[model samples]
Target: MRYSASHKLETREKLLQSSAVSAKRSGFSTVGVDGLMKAIGLSGGAFYSHFSSKDELFASVVESELRQSLERLGAEQDRDKLERCLKQYLSMCHVEHPETGCALPALGAEIARSDIAIRQQAEHWICQLQESWAQVLESDSLAWAILSQCIGALVVARMLATTELQHKVLKSSYDEIGRQIAGPGA
Candidate 1:
């Protein structure tokens, strides 16, 4: 059966989206190509039609997830809008829902361990996100700091066993970032 180009593209999109959610929810390496394909109602053999290898699929997932994160978290130019984004990002809802939230907190460890090519792809989107904040804040260091804080806070929050501690982790980070953004005098 020969599928049209658009149909192939749609299948690929479904595969990517399903793979990303699975990866974020349960480390990318844990799931095989068969599992990824199974999630999208296709056989494992069809995987090759969309990607050359599992690594290639992973790279695509990384790019897709991070680009989406960039659009959600980095599109703001004003301080108020950025702060609002941060608040939502640092909430318990985000911590409780790794499958649908930003990829950084969910997949940072895997991304750090991936090949140089994957790391570079992650860096491209991450740097673009930082630049958006940098332009708004007028300080590259601050942008980087806040970015790290947000991801780290989420990671730590999710690690804790109790929701109380998780909320503390998130609230503290949110407070500190707000203070930093307000500057020394404020």
Candidate 2:
């Protein structure tokens, strides 16, 4: 019995989707092939048919996750996009829900230590993300600053033990970013 090419593509997409969730929810480095296969109801033996290696999956996951982050952060949305996107991203809801959130806060450092190929792929998406933000925010400097701050704030908020502190980090960063982007005296 052989699967059609479209079926194979569908299965591969399923695996990528599940892997993206697992990578964002847990560390990408922490999820094994068996676990990822189990997630899509496929046997571990079927894993190789989709991805050549875990490193390959890591790169794909990074690409998929960053694409999502770009969309969620209002990649090509209108002028009010930044503020609206930040309101969602810097909320406690996002902090508590890692599965549906941006991958950067959860796995940026981990991916930074990945193989050169994966790191290069990540750098491409990172620049793409910056470009997306730059489109709406106008200045490359402002785009980089906001993206760095958002990633840092979420990472710190996720690390802390208390919800209060987490919300504080989120709110403070949110307000500060809004002010900075709003320009002087804003």
Candidate 3:
């Protein structure tokens, strides 16, 4: 019994979505192909039907996650909207919910450790996101600075043991970014 093309596509989508969430919540390198397949209600053997290897699936996951991030954060055409987006990104909710939030802070280290091809794929999406912001902010450097700060803030906040410290990290980053955006020609 052969599956139809649509069935194959749907199954692939499900696998990608489940694997991405798992990777963000846990870590991509830590989870094996069997586990990823299990998350999508399939056996390990079914994974190769969608992707050649775990590395391929990871590349796909990184691309999918970063593309979604670009869609969410890159669409803001004005400073106010961008600030709101950043605020949400740096919130405690995002810190506590890695599976549902941006993949950067969650998987940055893993991406860095990945092979060159995956790193290049991540770089492409990240650059697209920065370019979108640069258009709105009219400064490439400022866009890069804010992007780095937001991701770093989330990573740092998540590492802290107490909610108070987490909040302090988030609020400080947001407040400083606000000042930077308000200064000079910004």
Best by TM-score: 1
Stretches off by above 4 angstroms in model 1 are: none
User: For this target, which candidate reaches the highest lDDT against the unseen true structure?
Assistant: 1
Candidate 1: the clashing residue pairs are none
Give one digit per residue, the lDDT tens place, for model 2 in 66-89.
877766774666658678888898
Q: What is the lDDT of candidate 2?
A: 0.87
Better of 1 and 2 by TM-score: 1
Would you list the rank order by TM-score, best first?
Answer: 1, 3, 2
Tens digits of per-residue lDDT for model 3, 112-184:
9999999999999999999989998889999999999999999999999999999999999999999888986
Instruction: Give candidate 3 misplaced runs (Cα > 4 Å).
Output: none
Question: What ranking of all candidate models by lDDT puts the best one first?
Answer: 1, 3, 2
Stretch of 10 with least lDDT, candidate 1: 69-78
Give Cα-based local distance difference scores for all models.
0.95, 0.87, 0.93
Candidates in order, TM-scores: namely: 0.98, 0.94, 0.97
**Count of backbone collisions within predicted model 2:** 0
